[model samples]
Target chain A: MYEAYWRGMGDRCSLVISGSEVMSYLGGNPGGACWFLEPELEKSIRRIHHLVGNAAAQAEDGGHVVVGTGSTQLLQAALYALCPPDQPEPTSVVCAAPYYSCYKEIAELLQSKLYKWEGDAHNFNKDGPFIEIVTSPNNPDGLIREPVVNRPNGKLIYDLAYYWPHHTPITHKADYDIMLFTFSKCTGHAGSRIGWAIVKDKEVAAKMTKFMEVTTIGVSRESQLRAAKLLGIICDDCQAFSTNTKSQNFFDDSKRLLTERWDKLHEVVKRSETFSLAKFPKDYCLFSDRFYETHPAFAWLISNNKVKDCASLLRGHKILTRSGNRFGADATYVRVSMLGREEEFNLFLERLSTIKIGICNGIAHIN
Target chain B: MYEAYWRGMGDRCSLVISGSEVMSYLGGNPGGACWFLEPELEKSIRRIHHLVGNAAAQAEDGGHVVVGTGSTQLLQAALYALCPPDQPEPTSVVCAAPYYSCYKEIAELLQSKLYKWEGDAHNFNKDGPFIEIVTSPNNPDGLIREPVVNRPNGKLIYDLAYYWPHHTPITHKADYDIMLFTFSKCTGHAGSRIGWAIVKDKEVAAKMTKFMEVTTIGVSRESQLRAAKLLGIICDDCQAFSTNTKSQNFFDDSKRLLTERWDKLHEVVKRSETFSLAKFPKDYCLFSDRFYETHPAFAWLISNNKVKDCASLLRGHKILTRSGNRFGADATYVRVSMLGREEEFNLFLERLSTIKIGICNGIAHIN
Candidate 1:
């Protein structure tokens, strides 16, 4: 989906690195909170975030940017930082229902003594200190959400992976204690495996940095330098074309592509009897300076009773999707990725439109 | 020390990447055991290892290569793979005394329930299942080591970070069940944060790959590709100059530089009364085709009883060193890095030659 956009942009975003540059283990900012984080990359992240008005990255707030291999590592780092090591019992980690599928798996992967996955936040009944992961413009459901568990001792990790203006409206600048953003969703450079956390508290940031050092010894400097270059290009384009609505900036271009895909998906869903798409209301985006509907990276599709398993039904048509059960939702729902190549997405829409409720009953047997 | 070698190589090892290349989350080998492992990088690693005669990476052995963010992550992955999740007790993970300091720190960082750090493999008397990490040409005290605990349930992870021909002689091709290597030590590309595991069992390889996916999604593609390019250059140099000793190859060039530094340090140690260096016997190196003494990246310096704290004593002289206490040894020893730039290495030798045993007692007070 984003390949064409980057290709059309030509060498303006390309990178050339010398063999001897950035070869040492320590990064440029050795004395900062994240000793291994490249200073230029940190500056680029703050500039982009401030330009987008998504998160508070100003130096006055004492926000420290801790870079990770990806947001996945950042998620684990956050859990490790928030949970007290000497606590008698493991800290309960909870997220809302229909949350990202990886939260539980990542939390329990190492079976850390400091924290344990306690399932959905709505069902969390414990009164002790807890950590709630709030994914705004959430993964499976594609809905903006806030923390469901309200407690004085509760901590929050806001995974704003999909909070960019192209995916969701620039809903007021998210002022949170900890916020995570990734280069994957923002610039469609998932292979770089670069993500950063904008943490407000100095101690928490230091602990997070320690987690990075103990885990992978810090994120890749090659990726950090490359990400800095890419983010600089994005910021440069935004500055040059801030008032030009017709110019194809990164956000505007991505939004245009996503809107077209969403429009096609809406048409397909309206005609289908076996599946229904989640509806999102129009919201004003400060970056684009207009009201727009969220054309999310994922489509939350609910299947009718005729289809016993939405994921299995889609599999019959050769369309791969994640089952809602993985996200703590009923199996009647399936999350379809809307970020595929154009031809592949067209094939998915074509296959999905042909999947009628009558055929849903015996689709598995026929396939 | 290795920086000058790489800088001398110039743009032959430099990398130019287009914006559209390697943008997808998936790698070229999506169906591989390590799905996110780049195919070219895997091929390059196998080629380099085969060329160096260090590890068994041949395709005929059905060996699988699992790439990680670095060898640090791979060590954790090896633990996760060797220790069964359903075990009644946490598997004891031990390395020999004077082991890599990070082995203990990384193992216990998460307080993992699957494995616990059981210090000093020589003292590990438990008869149950255990994971032993064997660091040949070890970090602090450079020496070849093998597992001391002989048991049927014991699993071994060979940390060959310093096994390159530049650091130690290649005695034979290692045919271990699991072997860990990193690009940081191989080419002094520490900022790349790339490492890999060669495993004989497919199940173990798959489990290690799963750990990588759950932890970091995968290592950075930019780093992986850059590593592949750098390794390719080394392999090409070896091929082009295999018969000529006069021509500069990667290993020969690095070994020459390391030999000079070691010679200077030996002269200083011979004259200093307060410090003694570790002894290493000359062994036949197949790659260099000569008998060569080990020139480890770190110097294990033992201080006399006059110095109470070796690390503190060095700190007073403006030298940063890790105390032997961190490596589970007495405080009379300190690990000094010999991999600094040429000027830094000279300054260290100059300062060490001026220090006498009489000053050790009053060093803390004078500083």
Candidate 2:
């Protein structure tokens, strides 16, 4: 769908793998600290934690790090860690409405009796062990979330996929008990498939590692090696990424691109009078100490009473969007991705503006 | 444990990853054929299948190929595909008495209601739905195995991890319903952690893919890319990895190394009067169309009645081996890895010779 946009970017985010890497496994070597993970990757992860002042890293109680294929794997590992095999009934996994859609599917797919998907955490009335997944800068809507229901046995999983400085402002050192972060959004290396979790408890981390061992025997050591190198580069460039006019850093380019797309969409929605968007405040970044513009991975757009299924409404105009129902939201809402390259984002804006022009001309096109 | 031995072999298996791969997450690009897999990888897998007439690949009954993180993950996936959630009870999964040790533990770890580890496929008489795991070129004891249970409703899972030409004689095309292979044994890239399954059933392949998607999402695309390139290189070099008369091809090198070590151990056991090795017969290879010597991934060694545990018996003489009890065999037997580099094999030979001298001197150290 974004092929033209990607072509226009033209090596802006292009990658080239060397022949040597193509020729060798270069992972899971006897020299590494463990059979599955590279020691350097672990060190780089530690370095990045300190550099970002991640809450878990800065907490009085230190956290253990476990790398995974991606945050999704880590999420499954977390669920595995939380639920023991001997439980009489499957533990409930609850997420708020407008939650990331994969939560329910991942839980139910295994048909694992250890845990079962029980919908919106707020309505979970059962008195038992349950897991609550909160994605800060949540996908689809891009809202910061907190645990709504407090239970003695409830375990909170903080998915910080979009909490990076480029995607959102670094408000404070985030020190959560179970937090997840991925290299994809932070450095735009989604193809690498590497993510890490910071856990406050030791046993949970060990169980998570055991799950990885019997699954894939752990993450790709080559991927981890590459991740380590790239992470070092990301850390080295972060401070000067958005500053220094001479620097062309990933964070700077990504933030500038997403902010422009978000603003353009906001203008188009306002002009259309047929759609609206939830307001995102310009918050002060604790690290940068400046008011940072809102640049979400996706824009959560709502129909202005004219359309029922806003996703289908957008589809009629040749623009595809994810329906709100996927996120357990009402039919009036839709999510349009803003992470596309300039050409695609601009095309979406153009189509959106044409809708506005049609509305002004008394052409009510909803059928 | 074998650090000194590994160092003695120098750069025989050293791997070097390059700088370009470090900069990018280079797989499943938008231009790639699919989001989860690279097109070249799928092609390479097919190419290797034809190059080595693996039974599942050559059979008149066409099969589908699914790449996995590793063969272990594929094993679990097969179990997941076989046991439906609606089943009244967990299906029983059984392997032979001296099966791969991991089969039982990995099955029981999840404590999945879908399947339970039931020992020995032959003894499983009350089974409603059962999976029979048959490991060809079985680990711990290097021998080709066949399914013992011929029940109508039984599903067979063939683990062909050591069926490659280097490890065993490719006597005929194997057309099993399901066969598993890995790059680790074929190309000596164990660290790559990539494996493929050839399945005769479409529904089974789809279920395996679903398991991957919900687990690690899929195999590491970067690893897949690397495996494809490496396999291509291996295939290209098969006719002439070593051009000179003094040098050897991978098959020649690996077979010669294992055979020499096997003969040395055979000589040592005869002299020691304290242990014995199962006789492995020489076989004819269909691929090479020549009589090939027996060369296995491991040597199954059995201590005399005087010893209670052969693993600990080896450990006493500064050698460590896996206990046969792990593979559901008696403690008197043990598994010695023969796949290590030449230096390690030489060290093992030296230690085995010493056991003979110890017996001759009436120093029966084993209890």
Candidate 3:
């Protein structure tokens, strides 16, 4: 999705790492809570968040930046940090309905005695203590969400991966205790596998660092240095430009790209009687200084009553999509990624627009 | 330790990554057993192992290469893959006494229900199912080791990190079910945090890959590419030279450096009344086709009874060494690193040579 923009930047975004640079596990961030986080990367993370106003000021909020392999590692680290090891039973981990599916898988992968995935937050009632993952501009359905089960004992891990201005409106600075952000979603460098958590509490931050240490012995220093350089480029561009200028600023250009994609997707969905999409209200984006509807990374496509399994239906048509059932929803819906290459996305739109649902012996069949 | 060697190589070993080269991950290794394990890296890994004659031939043995964040994560993955999740009790995980302390911590860190750390394989009795870690040319003691607990149900994870020719002789091609290696110890690229496990079973490899996916998504693409490049250089050097060549081949230069350090260390230990070093018998290395004494990355320094806490004694002398007790050994033994920079190693040797044990009011003290 973001490869073109980066490719266009060319040598300016290129990273040249010397043979001897960052050959030790310990990075240059001597004062950082996370020992392995590079100081330059930390600075870039804080600056980006400050510029976007999606997260509270790092210094004022006492936030410590902890880098991980990706938000995937950070999520697990957060679970490890928040949940006490000596707990009598595994603490119930719940997320709202239609949440990111991997939450359940990641939480339960180790069969960790510290925590257990108990499914949807709406169904979570018998919790002495729990963890609610709030993925605003949620994975399958792109709706701005708040904690469904807000309780004093319920710790929250706010996955702000899709909270960027291009994806959705940055309504206000989030002052959450724990927030996870990834370079993958932020800049489409998923291959880099760089993610970080902005944590408020010192002890939690230390514990997260310990988790990183014990797990992978800390992230790759090469990745850290590269992320720092790339992020620095983005921040530098934003600083140089005051208003929305095509190709001048990263966020502006990305927003323009996403908006165009969303418009095309809306047109396809409108013309096709077989599918429907959620209608988002126009919200004022503080970062962009304008009103815009949410242009999520994924489109939650709802099939008409004739189709029972939307994902299988699309699969038959040679279009790949994740079934909504994976996100604890009915299989009638499928989550189509809006963040593929332009040509791929266009082909998917073309395929989706031409699909016809016909009744064959009282059973709906794709023609 | 190896920084100087890499630094001297200059641009020949340097890596230049363009912005869009490996952005989406799903690396160039589409046919690899591990989805994200880059093709170039897998080839290099197999080639190195083949060149060194450490692990069995990858193709002939049906071995699948699983890249990890480091051997740290790979160890956990091996444990995850070997242990059955549905087992009534956590599978006993044991290593020999004076094992790497991290094995105990990492195994029990998550309080995982699948496996539990049962210290010292020698002490491991009444085990129905168990996983034994055999760190040949072992961490603290630098002696070639095999699985202590030999049983039908006992699975083995061979940590051959120090099994390289420089550290120890490759007496035979290791044909273990699961063999672990690291770039850190192999090429002295510890900061890269890249490690790989060569497994005979496809199921085990798939499970390990799944563990990587759920945990940190996968290893960094940049690090993989860098390791591939570094390994390629090392292989190319070896292929170009038939015999030992100074500064021309990686292993030859490294072994030369380690030999010199060990010689100096042996002299210091021989002269000092407070300390004694292990005497390893000369063994024929197939790669070099010569008999050479072990010159490990670490020195297992055994102190005289008068200096009970050798690590503390060294700390007082301004030398940092891991406490022997940390490796489940007595306080009289401290593991001193021979892998530090030349200046630091010299300072340590100078301080170590001058150290004297004194009795102050019947209690032993370092003077």
Candidate 4:
């Protein structure tokens, strides 16, 4: 859907990688030698981590960063590192209800005896070693979440994929033991397939690097270099435009556009009796030093009427959405992607506004 | 080691990826719909396979090709697909002795209950389902190999990373259920981290795609596009330089240089009584339709006498080589990479030739 949008934009989000940018297989060594990440990517990650006041900035030594093909790969790496192979029983891995579908699938599909996907984190009460995946500013619902499975043996993997300034409040320097960030949501460069993690423990960092070594050897150096270059541009722009919200940095511009789209979407949702949307309260942002509106990557839509499968209803309206069932929730809730091109979003709004819900005995029904 | 060599070559091997190369994420689709793989990459792969008469060249319908981050990930994917998770016992994965060290390490490190690293293929006589990894023009030994354990339940994975024109004679179109290839070994773009597989079975291909879906989602579009462009250049050059022995294509130039280096290394080894090297005979070529000599990526060096651990001995002489133990081989052998920069190789040769070997009673000692 966004392909046509990007094609129309003519290199708006894409980046050019120079011929000589890639010349070595070793990006950064596993032992915090800066060899696990491409040098420029490492530098950019450090700069951005500092600018965002996220986990890396809070560390005494900037923490150890592990670069991956994407946050999904990092997610897998985190799981691989935390779980030992010889666990007596498969270590239960869980995420909260309305979680990212990929987590459940990846955990189950990799299917190690050391770990098993055991559904919602809220339901798990297992005493043995377990892993809880925490997706903050959650994928579908756009809610800030904390680990609910507060067990002593439970480890938390905070996926900060959408914690960028544009998506949520800066809040604080998010220092944590393990955290993941991606260029996809932050810079809208999903095609690059680059993501990174900031780990306080060197052992965990080394283990994550080992995971990468066996999986893809390492992420693409070209993608890493391209991400580095783009991050540099964004940081430089932010510096120049720090005083003004109308400045041309990526977050400023992306947020403004998202704000308008969200308003339009809200208006459309309000007019419909069949569907409702998740509400995110304004939060105090450290970067802006003020309350900021939410700009989520997706709209978690709930059926307020007889629409049992919101996704199927949306499909009938010619506006495709991912079913809440994919996220281990009921079919009444669906996730609508908010990260597409401007035209794609506009079309989604147009189709959604025109959607006619079915009525039975004066009750609103599926569209 | 090769970093300075490439830095010295400047743009001789480097590739330029245009800004517009990665405007979309939908490469060819998993169902062979041309949605998951970049169009150019798919085309270039098809062309190269056809030109070289390699794996896909002999396919009945051009077979299914799955692109990965590198063959390492594909290696994992293949293992995931071929082995059922519910198998009562873990399937043993074996490569020949003196194999690529990463194979065993990756198999063990991933540690899925479905598969276990079972040392050398020669030692595996397991009754149940197993995977035999055959690296033709094998990693360290440069010996063409077949599955020794040809059990009905045994699966064979052909890693043809070195079967290209530069490394070895393209003997025939390799039609196999699973075959692996990489741009790193072929085009010297290790930084790209892109590799692919030609799988005859659709079910297996789908499984591989599923693995990517849960891992990185897909390879970098920029890397894929870059690989496609480079492959196009190589294939085109191969076409134009097909008949000319003095042709200046990449493979031609690379092979010419490798031939010279191999000859020089052989000369150096001839002067020493303590070392011996693997020898390859001329083979009939299907790509060029003529006999061609070998130019392996790694040199298999055996310590004939005086040095029990050849890699350790080389390290003492200030030269680095992979120990034979890493490949489940005896300590008398070592694997030396041949693709390093010109200066690095020269230095390695100088150090290796001047190394003093211990002698017993005026005779070269076996220890």
Candidate 5:
């Protein structure tokens, strides 16, 4: 689990990655060490300012940009800035169920109540007095929904953390008051800790900037430069990689591998006949039917009677899976990351088959 | 100035520097993303348990470590946590003159009153009812003073931003209620945005942590790893470089170069008779002497009204220097960074000589 978390989020382009480029821009000066000033630092700042404009131009509304230590920091900054302590704190934050789990907790930590709108596969009810946190292609589920209503007076902070490649560009919806995005997700560099917010309203952006200044002062210069560098690199890569025939062929190969694993897991669950499918949204890319079978709570059901939770069964076979409870769901559900090689998935299948035979024959006790 | 800031603060091993390291360690993740969980993030809660132990070890009284985007954010967090909105705010923060300038601005931004205890080179008065901000070997003008007496029940937040290499360690002193330090200075990485506080009281630390959790969540994980990596490298460098005779020789050569510039500047100031020595105790470093001629205020004086008020004259030469007013001192003064190379200093002196010659002949104007 630790390895997965680290590998999934920890692969980042270190600041040293662009040292040569930075040095070239710096006129061979190793760094701005002699004085408390550097021309390259100024140049980097100007570059960021330009990028901000570029990002703003791409947004639905051309709003002011305020940067933060990361999008996570900016999220907290937005809440603190918008939600005044003097007022009765908003009754609760309205978030889609299976949303980014942090939104509810952050709101609760701020003493704000949370209201979950359990949006299943087909529906989203938009009416709510509370601030709405809308994530496109939401985490865990990875399904995109464009809410029909435009809530003007109602505060809305959109988490566009995963909206880059997979989801449609709905930033032009003209309803989002604040939008958040991080470099970690888009560029496969999670560690630089750079994120920015695009607020349609100037007054809102100003408050957030002030809040950020007081909070983290500013994002790290090193991270900002590296972010700018990686952003340029990734944008180029995205354009090139998307068009390459080989890349498309590779995608097909990967999908085939994933489908096979999904089918095998489906067969296993069907054969066991001990569990029934709760709900499987076809629109969701990840979180397939296999996710339901191996959940800890369901595993608990089987474990008490010679059955094992999917995560534990997978884990017993050296496969790591995230406990569903971590995502504000029942422990009976476990999330198996769909990110693995075909061989790895086959290995996971082999382990599940072994566990199933043992449990059915009363050779292995669930407990 | 930006270059100087980096040269003074940037780490050698890691390109990124910031105060995010505190959260990375405490929250067990690099970025403060856990703070945004819809449900409480389990890792954050689990990490906090271990952080409490670490904090206990670091603090005089058992305390908790609340993570912030940076020490600056923590500063604001401390303000939010301590100052009640219900009561009339405290009249002002009584910071030592020539202190870190951010103290007054942060207080004012919070709408608190601000007062200055203008300390001359010889002595600083120790009496005050206001929150006191103390900096040892302070910025621009480095000065360290031993604490005389504790003001019973009064608040003191020490800025130890530069208290790493040049200043003596005083973390052992249990008198301070809160102390702030950043990885930027010690580890030479300001981009990671990691800073920490040692609060003598557990309640104070807890309050601060809550504010941080609400405001910034936690620092970045990628930054933390980079910092941890850089810190190891810095420690290794310190050990390796300190023992190397060649490194000592390099410093000796650099000091000789600096001494020549200082002597030339002293001679020019003596001949001009426009500026006089700023008094200091016998134990003060040679860098203090640069203030007379190289300081922005002094240069400003020479360039304005045939050497009139130091602030205006310095501006005329296209030289950027911080006015003393920013640091709660008389407008006649300005702080200049003495971190330039010998050639840079020589060029500055040449400009000064020309300005002096122009001023004496009434050819220079304050405009």
Candidate 6:
């Protein structure tokens, strides 16, 4: 987990050297009375100011709220600060089924009872007396669910992790009570470990900030500065280019690769009558409709071993993919991220064909 | 605050750019679901493994803990995990007076009642019935108290922020339940916003970890990796470089610089003869002695002149310093951080001497 943070932040080479210097200074030299002088800290903070815009702007605009440490740390702070230790326990958290696995883990960790609302690929009603987590363009399946924005009963916490690729360019319009975004998914910088929250209420923001103060002291000043710098460049590029060029390119690449693989997978499933597949939503940014159509049977096949589950299939072919079970889906439904290069996608498709044919022949021979 | 973290890690220009690139990819990109991909996460985690040391070793030895965003986060987590929510009230925290200002803030923030034990610099005792905070070479005054290896009646939470610089070498031998360390103070990497606590008790560590899991999800994976890398380098250097050369050189520079400033300040006080000075413990690190001797009159001068405090001195001389009152010390005692190159230091000394004489004369004239 720690390493991922460094990588995500783009600290590849110097981390060891810097760590060594710190250990040496602390453990060996022991300079009197002035070891607390943090020269680098001042510099890093100054640099981040440029990236995130004026710190004052963040306070005033209710945006650019860079988090401390991991987004999880902030999440915990939000729960603690908003829920109040003294108040009656929160009724429950309403989470979309097949949501990010950690949402449940975090809720459970906070001792908040979770209420899962299963929904189709299109939309999920946000109604209940609980905190609602609307993860747009859901994970594993990559289907975007337009929020039921008018639901007034529960507080809304939007995890727009995959929303960038699937939804229209409406990030500016997302005026939620609290919205979470991370650096890992969007930019392929999984190691930077930076995240932010766009929060509306001042009281809630203050509580969250205080909670952050108690929890992490603040996010890594270094990470924030770096994130701010990168974000600045991105924003500039986005503004200067005719369209949201970077995002469009990303979407195009993702779609082309995903569609190519999905078609191949569909052909294989059709050929192998014994094996089944899960269908995908028509407007989905990932997986195809053909897979979703046969989802029930596919689920049974995976459970009964008529065909190998996603993890096994991928592992067997030295290909790595996420198991559907982690996302509240059947074991048979595996999410094959199309973020890979073209050759890698081709290889995956080839492997899927071979694996399905082999599984069918093996079953027939046994019969 | 955010920028300081990166600077603390000692990241150079090129690495900063690359780090920014990674940040953009992970954070600013569209779809933002990249964090969910385990492969990317694994790559980051693997790097951190090398930086922090064998994860296996950390698990086995249980001492090699990675830091989160800031020590405060870990502290909050500890409180949350250890303190029962069902309890009627928050836990009571006992702290030594003139301790780190944040200790009190954290306790209060947690809704815990704080019990402060004021201590005389010359003669102090360490017996309490609360979670005692023993800051070795304490803040504000730089006094290193004896260790409490066995707390028969209460719990001990030690803040070793200044522990590294005061002694000949940093020693992790002050057997306590939880020991806090920060890179900002120790490594001059305040901006990194990374801090960790070494908890001897497994239960405490587990609870803290669980709390952390929910809060920030984990510290920025990127920052941790960078920290681990930096620490690893320092460790390697400590092994390779003999203490005689590197250690001596390091301390000699700091001692020479600090002693010269201290002597100069003492000479100024002696010449002025307007206020009496207090004596400090031989092992004390902060400039508390200087303040104790000279501050009563300084306070009178400030009050009479309607100058708010020492921080206002910046307006007069373009010199920045912290107000001592912030550290639970006399309001008149302003903390002048010794930061500057030699020439700058000389200029500061000259300005300080002039200010001292001018202030004394003005007081006398007014009287």
Best by the DockQ measure = 3
Model 6 lDDT, full chain set: 0.46
Can you write out model 1's per-residue Cα lDDT over B1-367, one digit (the tens) per residue? Answer: 7788888889988878888888988988988889999998999999999999988898886789999999999999999999898888999999999889999999899898999999999898987999999999898888988888878899999999999999999999988999999999999999999999999999999999999999988889999999999999999889889766566688988888898999989888988767888779999998778998999999999986447698887887888899999998988889999999888988998888877656644663332
lDDT of 2 at B257: 64
Provide the lDDT at A282 for model 2: 79
Clashing pairs in 2: A55-A174, A55-A175, B55-B174
lDDT of each: 0.89, 0.73, 0.89, 0.79, 0.47, 0.46
Instruction: State which docking tier applies to candidate 3.
Output: high
TM-score, one value per model: 0.98, 0.87, 0.97, 0.92, 0.59, 0.60
Model 3 interface DockQ: 0.86
Interface DockQ of candidate 5: 0.17
**Greater-DockQ candidate between 2 and 3:** 3
Q: Model 4: runs farther than 4 Å from truth?
A: A1-21, A28-34, A58-61, A243-247, A358-367, B1-24, B28-34, B58-60, B243-247, B359-367
True contacts kept of each: 0.85, 0.33, 0.88, 0.56, 0.23, 0.41
lDDT of 5 by residue, B234-352 (tens): 33443455577443221223334444555676686677654444422333223212212112112212222334356556667755667766766655566664445446666666655
Q: State the interface C-alpha RMSD of candidate 1.
A: 0.9
For model 6, residues A1-367, the per-residue Cα lDDT tens digits are 1123224334332323333233211211123111222233223323333332222223344543535344555555555555545434343455555656666666554333223233322354534444556776555444455455345555667776544431222222345677666655544444456655656675776677666555445456445545555444444443444354443233234334445555666686566553555454433222111212111101212322434465666576776766767666666556565545457656866665555433455442212
lDDT of 4 by residue, A1-367 (tens): 2233234334444565434456468755444523558777877888887886755543366478889999999988898899887777887899999999998888877567768899988888778988888888898888988989887888989999999888888887777788999988777778889999988888888889878877787889888877887787677767878876555666666777777878889999999655788778998988767798778989988877646777877888789899999999999899998877778888998888887677688555544
Alpha carbon lDDT at A317, candidate 3: 88
Q: What share of the true interface contacts does candidate 2 keep?
A: 0.33
- Model 4 complex DockQ against the native: 0.51
Q: Give DockQ: model 6.
A: 0.21
Q: List DockQ for all candidates.
A: 0.85, 0.31, 0.86, 0.51, 0.17, 0.21
Model 1 segments beyond 4 Å from truth? A243-246, A359-367, B244-246, B359-367
